[model samples]
Target: MFGRIGRTSVKHPWLTILAWVVAAFALVALAPALKSTTDQADFLPSHYESVQVGKVQERAFPEQDQPASIAVFWRDDNGPLTDGDKADVAKVTESLDKAGFNLVKKIETSPEAVSPNGKIALASVVASVKDPYDEKLLESVKELRKKAAPLLEGTSLKMGLTGSAADALDSQESSGDTDAMIMMATLVLIIVLLGVIFRSPLIALLPVLIIGVVFMVANGLIATAAEVFGLEADASVSAILIVVLFGVGTDYILFLLFRYREALREGQAPKQAMSDAVANVGETIASAAGAVIVAFLALLLSSLGMLRAMGPALAISVAVTLIAALTLVPAIFSLLGEKAFWPSKAWRKQPKHTLGKRIGDLTARRPGVVAGVSGGVLAVLAAGVLTFHPTFDAGSSLPDDLESVVAMEKLQSGFPAGQTDPTWVVLEKTSDGKLEQAEVEAFEKKLAASGFGEVSPGVIGAGGDVAQFAVLLKEKPSSDAAMELVSGKLRDAAHDAAPEGSRALVGGLTAVFADIQTAVNRDYSLVFPIAGLAIMVILGLLLRSVVAPWYLMLAVGLGFGAALGSTVWLFQGLQGKDGLLFTLPVIVYLFVVAIGTDYNILMVARLREEVRRGQNSADAVRHSITHSASTIGAAAIILAGTFGVLLLAKNSMLQQMGFAVAFGILLTAFVMALLLVPAVTKLIGPRAWWPGIKSDTARPAEPGPLLTEAPAGDRASV
Candidate 1:
């Protein structure tokens, strides 16, 4: 099937290229922009307690809305506020409220808003819409900051905005041109690496051109899918997509080019060599991509809407890159023919692989020693998994200099750390009748005495069937301590002290983070096994041997552990970070396990091919490694380099992710695929192919030398 595709592409290169161009243009012009949501509740199912609280707030306590942003006021001299300062703050609040900014519903303050120490005061900015991250709502936050500056010119008070809306605006502004920066870095890295390896400007620039088009098409399709299906893409999706397309896209292209060059040196015509290249590596590429797609699609089982949406989106991206690899890449290269290697005659003959030969010879001679050492290295790194910690603090990813982050730190000095976004404990009469006043007061007293934080007096809803008690935790809302309190003691206390006729539901930012932790834990259990099983099935089908798939997947699993463990060591141990991004494990799992599988498939397929050519087990291992090592090494470096660029980002989350994925890919290529897999297969011998192949005995018609001529300065024979 792939041979026929290669033949058609080579036969009519212009037509194939034209089709891609037209499709890309059409999609870009017609597709809608992808939309994302920042609301934590949007990512959770309605059944979760936090989500349920949002629904109840809308229906029962509509008028008692949470502040979208808080305007924190402090004395310029860092002293306690005097009467004149307090009066100026009130005037500024009133003036800003009357300014009529879009989405600004009201700005409210009172004597109680002042801190007990009189060092700080607050004005809560409530929004007309519930989504604090809404663009217009964020605009209101910006406008409020601007208006407040002039009003405070003569006063001793200084104001800075903090809270959901202001934080969102600051985060967006601080990450200025991050997407463009990643794109430029990835392109430059690819071009430089390719140029150094191939010594051909054309070869280096070819992937950029091809993948640039793939980028346009993939993004258009993702946007279109989101619009039609109403999927909630996260803000991070596009940045991730850039890496996936360039990294994986370049990988598939290199696979084809390597095989194409190999066939050419073996004396086939350029067009015929291209056809053979497609036929030889097509199954391997397809199987590899299939594994990645299946693993990504497994995210559909995730309880969080973000993972669910990300799964199909990434799956779609891999699928597109696969098509381009088999079709568009071949079409263009086939036309260029020998000129693709212009300015360098390296493609004309087989080059000596000094490092490849030594590694291959070692594995061929002592499979057990090689396997033991490689496996042992992975095991040692895997120990770091025990120290893994997860954090849900998105604010930590923002620059400390950001207004919201700075103000938040200042606010903590005068208020409870969780006062910015307090947890709400709701009590509702189950029978839709008014709750007894005594019961309401009793519930508030219980929550206050629970010792989690201060609890406000219960505010009854207009319907009288529902009431809310805000608990200001002593820790930051997204902190581990706050989450534990909300998910454990506070929840237990609320349920235990609810009025006899009422039920208690705990909901707020901390409650939301606690619920997310639950959903992620559930995802870990369900998604990992399903994805691993699915990839194993693909390997089994590709190799036609159940035995090969098992060990192959095991190696990939070990690689994942090593990658994650190394990340833990770097960030949690060496860097002294308390925890990694909560989603880091899932990100590392999918990228390392799925994409890493590609290298495994390539090596195993080559080993299988050499075996089919009637080479002995040792000979096959040596021959396969000698031929496949350069391709895998080059491709891995490019992919890893692209991900490594993320370390340059200001956001710590991006930096951690960048390092994990980059290091993981290198480990997969050098250790798992290059060393571990070949050694194990050498030890397993012909039985590894049992139930699929008859024997490892040399076939009379398939005669070949085990070792080809060594390049200059290398051993004459293996």
Candidate 2:
């Protein structure tokens, strides 16, 4: 099948190239803009308590105001706020009102809630608009910032905008930096590593150039698909897609190039070598990509809308990458011919027994010892799985230097921890009946008596049909305790305390994050099994052996467990954290299990190739490992290193994700690929390829197949 594909691509390289160009242009021109949402509530289903509460509030207290941003004010010298300072704050608010920002509702200032030290005061800016994340609101924030700057120029008071808007702006700026850093680092590392491996500038530049085209094409298509399907992607998805496309795209390119080099050394012309390279490595690349795509598509089962949206978007990206690997990469190479490796005569000679050969020999000599030792290391790390916990604190995901974080800390000292963002309860008449003032007062008294820390005076509806109360908790809103309290006792109290004709709703960050947790938990059960099953099917088809797929999947699963276990041990047991970020498990599972299969497929495919070439099972395992190890190891190291740079992000979620993925890739490459796979193949012997003639001793009628045409001396060198 792959051979036929190679022939068609090589036979009409120009046609293939032209098709890619047309597709790229059409997709880019037709694709709709990809949209992202930071609102946690946006990702949760309407059935969740938080969403339910939001619905209730929308219907009951439609006139309620939501603060779009907050302005935190303090004296520059850290002294008491004088009368002049209070007037200055008022003047700033007046100036913002005069500026006529379209989204600005009314700016409210309070001098009474100044800090005990008298160094700070607070002003809240509410938006008339419904969607706080709307770009217009961001524009309003920008205008407000500009207007407030000069209003305080001559005053001793210094003010900082510290709220959702500020946090959003900061997040956007930091994400831009992270994207630039990841791209630059990935490019430099890939070029340097590829240059070292191939020792040819053209060979090094080949992947960059080819994958660059693939990225543009893949992104354009992904955007089109996302738009057509109404998919929601995060800003981070673009950066991630770049890494995955280049990293995995480069891996497939290297796989083909390695074989192309081997074929060339066997005296095949550049054109025939290119065809043979694609034919030989094509199934492996396809299987690897199929696994990744299935895993990403599994995200559709996620209860969180964001994951569901992201799943198909990433799946589309990988699918395009796989197509390019099979088509675009080979076409470009076919055009470049022997000049692709120009300036490097090293391909004419083979290196001495490499590190991969030594490791393969070790595994072949004592499969039991290698398996036992490597498996034991992973098992020990897996012990940490018991300590793993999930954190709901979104604040922890943001940089501590953010003004919202700083002001939040300050607010906690003087006020209740949840004062800045309080949980709201709206009670409305359900039967088109008027809500009595006495009933509303009674409900507020019940809430205040429920030990909810503090309850603001109730604001009655203009028509006397509804009332809203702000409930402050003693704990930080995103804390586990807070979520638990809100999801449990507080919700129960609100329901039980409401009058017969009225309904009560609880809505806030804590409630929303708690609901998100439930959504993610549901996703785990739905996505994990489906993704695992889909990948197993791919493995089964690629290997043409049912039993092999089962064990191969088991190996990948163990790798996932071991990776999560190690993270749990480090973050929770050693560092004394309550839990990891809630989304870490899914991220780890998707990357580790999906990409782990790439290494497994490469090794298994090479093993089958060696076996087909008439080597016995044990010798085939050793030969395959020895031959494919360097390529797999180099690719894994580069991919893992690229993911490791995510730790450089200021966000904790990115930090944990970076460490988990990077470590998982290393574990997959070194422990599983290098050790477990070979040992198992040795133990299974020829039976590992049941239902296939991989174990049969049959030689081709011809002198040698194109893929195995490397000289005996060169084989020994590999």
The C-alpha lDDT values of all candidates are 0.85, 0.78
Q: Residue pairs in steric clash, candidate 1? A: none
Model 2 alpha-carbon miss at residue 630, Å = 1.2
Per-model TM-score versus the true fold: 0.94, 0.91
Top candidate when judged by lDDT against the true structure: 1
Residues 139-222 of candidate 1: C-alpha lDDT, one tens digit per residue: 878878888888989788889999989988987777667788778888998899778877889999999999989988998999
Model 1, residue 57: C-alpha shift (Å): 0.6
Candidate 2 residues 1-718, lDDT tens each? 7787887888899999999888877767776777777687878888776787777667666877878777888787767789988988888877777677878888888767576677778788888876666778887887777788888888898777755666566556554577777888888878988888778788788788777777777777777777777777765688778778877887777777787787788899877878887776777788888899999988887888888877887787788888888888778888888787788777778766577678878888888898889888887887777677898776667777776677677666566777666888778778787888889899999999999778988888666777888888999888889989888899899989999988887888788987888888878888898888998888778767777777777788788888999888766777676678887887788677777678888887777667766777667767777777777777888888888998888776677888898999899988997788778877787778788754546554224342322112123232
The lDDT of model 2 is 0.78
TM-score for predicted model 2 compared with the true structure: 0.91
Top candidate (TM-score)? 1
